[model samples]
Target chain A: MLNYLWGAMIFIGILVAAFTGNMAEVTNGAVNSAKEAVTVCITMLGVMSMWTGIMKIGEEAGIIRSMSKGLRPLLKWLFPSVPEDHRAMDHIATNVIANFLGLGWAATPAGLMAMEELQSLNKHKERASNAMCMFMIFNMSSLQLVSINIIAYRTQYGSANPSEIIGPGIITTLVSTAAAIAFAKAAEAAS
Target chain B: MRAISVLSDLILPLVIVYILSCGYSKKINVYEVFIEGAKEGFKIVMDILPTLIGLMMAVGILRSGGTLELISRAVSPIVRRIGFPPEAVPISLMRLVSSSASTGILLDIFKNYGPDSFIGRFVSVMMSCTETVFYTMSVYFMSVKVTKTRYTLAGALAANVAGIAASLTLCQYLWG
Candidate 1:
């Protein structure tokens, strides 16, 4: 799926640029954007390391376990395919907590771990399970308690009230999370 | 709202204190554990670097080639009816595809219209509220080596659209 999307994007970009005589801009964009990607990751490295370290402390101290215990009921409801004692639940909880804090870079490792654990439980090796789909939906639409990245951008841009959008951000994400859960449930039912 | 804001502000400090105290009570080597996790974090960054570069380059090419503008113009009428500014069409379109690219678009919007401006605030909310659906799905699925992602993309994209709608609507009610 992503393979097709990537191919189409590059193909259409070059074709359109050629027709519009914007090939120079395309060339520049490719180089600059690739550099931008590295720069973005470098910026993310600090935050990711900090949060993941703290989360590691949390994990070693059993905070993550307690947190996962707190979320057990709801998570169980969300992912029926995953068992109660499964390691995937812990990973899922960690991912959800990281996402809620708006630590997306920190969340990816846990999210990947969750997917890998869930995959281990799958009978069909090639196909994604319902639990996997639900987990993806929740991770993708995870409600953020603090949008640190956007706030950082706002402050950098010199906004007088950098946090003003926090209210709308929370509300909008809550709505989207509800929608994601509902869509996942519907999709699961259909499948 | 004020209480929530305060709590949000305190979350970092609270988490840090809680973790430190918990580690202390457990007599765990917090520093060593933290360094280990940090190393893993760097490894995670290295793992995703290629995907990030590919996604960014693709999105950048599309944007620079004027494909996004063309698509934005085509979608303007419907977007206008939903009360979103035409300028935000690109951000919304790119939000699901690549987060860094969307941030770049957001910075452009902020520069053009001050961050305090309605469009700027709207785009900020939109960007904060939504996830990079395709990028996330690809990375996650790739990690698990799941070639047949059944309904994950559809579900995520649906959620993204919902987020975009809610962002536009809430921004209008709160800040418009």
Candidate 2:
């Protein structure tokens, strides 16, 4: 899927640039974006490392376990296919918590681990399960309690009140999350 | 808003203190475990570097080639009918596929219209309210080797649409 999407993007970009006589801009964009990608990763590394280290202490100290325990009822409701005591639930809870806190860099590792754990429980090797689908929906539209990135950007751009959007952000994300959960549940029932 | 900002600032410190205290009480070597987790985090970043680079380049070409502008123009009429500023069309569209590209668009909007402007606030809210659907789907499914996504994409895109609609409506109601 990604292969085809990536190929088409590059191909169509070059073709369009040729017709538009903007090949030079395209060349510069490609080079600059490639460099930007590395810079982005390097920036992410510091945040990711710090959060993951704290999360490690959290896990070792059983904070994560307690967090998962508190989240069990909700997790069970969301992923009925997975057993209540499964490790995937813990990872899912951690991922969702990280996402809710607007710690996307910290969420990826736990989200990946959750997917892997869910995959292991799958009877079908190549196909994703209903639980996995629901998890993805929730993660994608996860309710953000605080959007640190947007606030930071607003501050950088010289907004008078950088955090004013928190109210609207929370409301919008809640709406999206509700929509995602409803859609996923409907799809699950239909199938 | 000030209260929320203060709370957000305290979250990191609170988490760190809680974790360290818990680890101490539990008689665990917090430093070693933290290093182990940090190593895993570094590994994960390394693993995703190639994918990130590929996506960035694709997004760059699409933006520079003027395809995004064309699409934005094509969608402007409908978007305008819905009361969303036509300038936001590009950001909303690119947002589904690439975070950085959409961010670039948002910065442009902020530059043209100051961050306190209606359109600027709308874009900021939208950015916070949504996720990069294609990027998340690709990276996650690829990591798990799930070739058959089985409605995950549909669900995510649906949520993205909901997010955009909600942001637009909320922004108008609250700030317009």
Q: Pairing residues by index, what is the TM-score of model 1? A: 0.73
Model 1 C-alpha lDDT versus the unseen true structure:
0.79
Point to the candidate with the largest DockQ.
1
- Per-prediction tally of clashes: 0, 0
Q: Where does the lowest 10-residue lDDT sum fall in candidate 1 chain B?
A: B1-10
TM-score of every candidate relative to the true structure: 0.73, 0.72
lDDT string, candidate 2, A39-156, tens digits: 6567557656666676777767767556666788888899999998889988999888778755566689999999999999988978989999999988888566666556655766
Give the Å error, residue A177, model 1: 1.4
User: In angstroms, how far off is B92's CA in candidate 2?
Assistant: 1.1
Clashing pairs in 1: none
